[model samples]
Target: MSSVEEFRTAFRDWLRADLTGEFARLRGRGGPGREHEAFDERRAWERHMAAAGWTCVGWPKEYGGRGATLEQQVAFHEEYALADAPARVGHIGEQLLGPTLIAFGTPGQRERFLPRIVAVEELWCQGYSEPEAGSDLGGVRTRAELDGEEWTVTGQKTWTSLAHRSDWCFVVARTEPGSTRHQGLSYLLVPLDQPGVEVRPITQLTGTCEFNEVFFDSARTPAANIVGTPGEGWKVAVATLGFERGVSTLGQQVGFRRELEAVIDLARRNGAAEDPLIRDRIARAWIGLEIIRGNALRMLDGVSAGAPGPEASVGKIFWATWHRELGELAMDVHGAEGMLAAGEPYDLDDFQRLFLFSRADTIYAGSNEIQRNIIAERVLGLPKEARP
Candidate 1:
């Protein structure tokens, strides 16, 4: 086997061996809609991953990582997903903010933040979306002002994933008064534990409370907490979005493929496979999984150039649509039973949860409409959408 293949083998072996004993319960526990499962246990699993040097493998060795090559990083994620490892608690810190810090952060910033991220000692959330600014990130109105040795931030951020569980947030705020759109913003690192920060979980249709609304009323971080420059945060924030869909997406597809296979199995068990339409949809889902993986690999080529570009939108729109459809397929395979709750109050079964949560798949990272606009204006150089 090639070295990358060998790396994959070793990684897979480690996962199989380590995800046992107290950790065995974590297998297939957390992912997408199931983020609410095994609350404390999943956090422990991430710390365990850190201790085993499995967390943040893509980070540079100097930042306490394996400095794994792109191929090696992809291998680890693939193996992790195939092993059905719990969803990581530190994705925002490890994948998104860590790289952003390395690329745009001052040495002091890197020294203070990167190590904790590698250790899973701190959790993070993205403070990008707001009530008025879903896909139009440029419309962020969260404002921050310098106050002596600190920057006081005030604004509300909604649909912030895991904000309630995170210890810090990388926030995009308007730093220059009267600035609009993407300009005059600053990427500030704000602590979530302080008096001025409030986290309110937003319950989803899945009956899970993974998403949250975060209120920052004069939340303060040091003056040096801003990444890049005070008024140039939009650039850093956009780069962070590029990293948002990186090599780990290849691994995501592995899990997605597994979900598709399970739905197929469900169809066969329930006799839905006998129906020509169900079989055709299953076949199409498989083909769609292949398309996702191919696009991710192609996008990986852009990593060396510093984050995937606007071209990444092509894959985003494709996979989001595919997964959403896969959710529908899961429910269809289950027939009428998919509509029933697993328990009283608000409990949901796997397929039901998948169906409801996948509804947000197209909306979260970026809405389908937004993704198409990026492809048109940025990637294809087409005419821009007119705004009021």
Candidate 2:
């Protein structure tokens, strides 16, 4: 078999063999809008995967990964999704921070961090968005100051995913006293268990607290925890964002395919499929998914060459909008039933949760408006937008 095909088959077999008994119940658990579901169980399952050398397969062997090729990594994700494995609990660490560290971290930093990430010993969260700076990361006002051997971080980061559950946060703070915008920023890894850090969960439309606001009041990390040169943190931070759009998304697309299938089945059972209009929308949704796959593949080429460039925003825009629309389509398939909760006390069915949560897909991970601006200014050489 070709290497990619062989990799796919091996992972598919492993998942089929292992996802039974205690882990069997974890299938389809702990996803978007439902992150509160079986979170502890999912974390255990991820640690199990790590034990078997299944996690961080794309990292170089020296970093404790299997050094799987790009195509192999893609196959791994697709197979994992097809197996209905639980949502990964360590993705933020494995896909984003690990790769960034590999590219920019000091040897001592890599030595201390990479193995923990590979083994799922420490979970990490991004500390990029804040009350005043969501899409425009350059507007971040979080500040970090070096005092002796440690850096004290003081700022509030909103929309931090899973900060309550994470052990560390990669924070983008203004390190230069007078700096503004992207300049003079530093990416520091701060521990969440410290007394100075507080995590407050934010209730969402799905009635879940997958996102949180993290307050770092004089939080401290060793000065060595900073990634890249202190004044050039924007470069390191941008690299992490590029990694966020990496190959794991193919697995996400697989989950999306399954959701689409479920929606189609719902339509068939409820007689919505008989409506030609509904049928057209379903077909269009399918087409859009295919386009999303293509965009992701094209973006991966950029990743293989180096860190993904502005083109990664294209895939992000397409998939986020497509997912948001798919959620709308699911509600439409439900017709009037979509309006009501599945049970009393705000219980929501899968479709209801999907509709409510996918609403933010386009807004998070860089909004549609910001993405279009990236494509226009960076990809198409358009004139910059006016700013006050």
Candidate 3:
């Protein structure tokens, strides 16, 4: 077998053997709106994977990964999804922060954090979006000040996914008093368990609280925790965003396919597929999924070389808009039943939850509008958008 096929077979066989007993109950649990489900169990399962050397398979071998090639990494995600494995609890740390550290962090930072991330001993959350700076990360107003040996952070971050559960957060805060628009910012690694940090859960339309508003009042981390030079954090933060669109997203595409298949099956079972309009939409969804896969592969070429570039925005726009439309189609397949709760107090079936949660797919990470602007100015060399 080709090395890629061998790698895929090994992991596939491992998953087949391991996903039984209590772990079998975890399949398809804890993703997006359903993050509340089996979270502790999922964390334990991730630690189990870490123990078995199945986590972070794409990182360099020196960093404790298997040093899997890009093809093998893609296969790893695909097979993980094909096995219906539980949604990964350590993805934020393993995918986002780990790559960023490898690219920009000091050796000491890597020595201190990478092993913990590899082992799923520490969970991390992104501290990028604020009430005033959701998509425009340059507008971040959170500030951190170096005082003696540590940096004291004080600011509020909203839409922080999994913050309530994370052990640490990588924060982008203004360190220079008069700095504005990305300059003089620093990305600091802050512990979330400190007394100065308060995480308040925000219930979403799906009635889950995976997203949170985090208030950091004089929260502190060692001065050495900053990645890259203090004023150059914008560059480092952008690199982290690039890593956010990495190989693991292929696993997400698999989940998307599963959702599409489920929607198609529901339509068939409920006679909705008899409608020409429903049939057309289902076909369109299938076509869109194919396009999404192609765009993802094309985008990965850029990431494989280094941090991805403006072309990454193209994949983001395609998948986010397509997934949102799929959610709408799912609601339509449910017809009037979609509007009703599955039970009292806002309980939702899978389709209902998918419909509501996918509404934000285009809005978060970077809104559709912001992504279009990124492509226009960064990719096409168009004139910058008029700003006040």
List the candidates' TM-scores in order. 0.98, 0.98, 0.99
Per-model CA lDDT versus the true structure? 0.90, 0.94, 0.93
- Candidate 3, residues 212-237: lDDT per residue as tens digits? 99999999899899999988899999
Candidate 3: residue 16 Cα off by (Å) = 0.4
**Which candidate model has the greater lDDT, 1 or 3?**
3
Residues 17-119 of candidate 1 have per-residue lDDT tens digits of: 8999999988888777778789689999889888988888888889888888889999998888888888888899999999999999999999999999988
Clashing pairs in 2: none
Span of ten consecutive residues with least summed lDDT in model 2: 1-10
Which of the two, 1 or 2, has more TM-score?
A: 2
What lDDT is reached at residue 25 by model 2?
A: 99
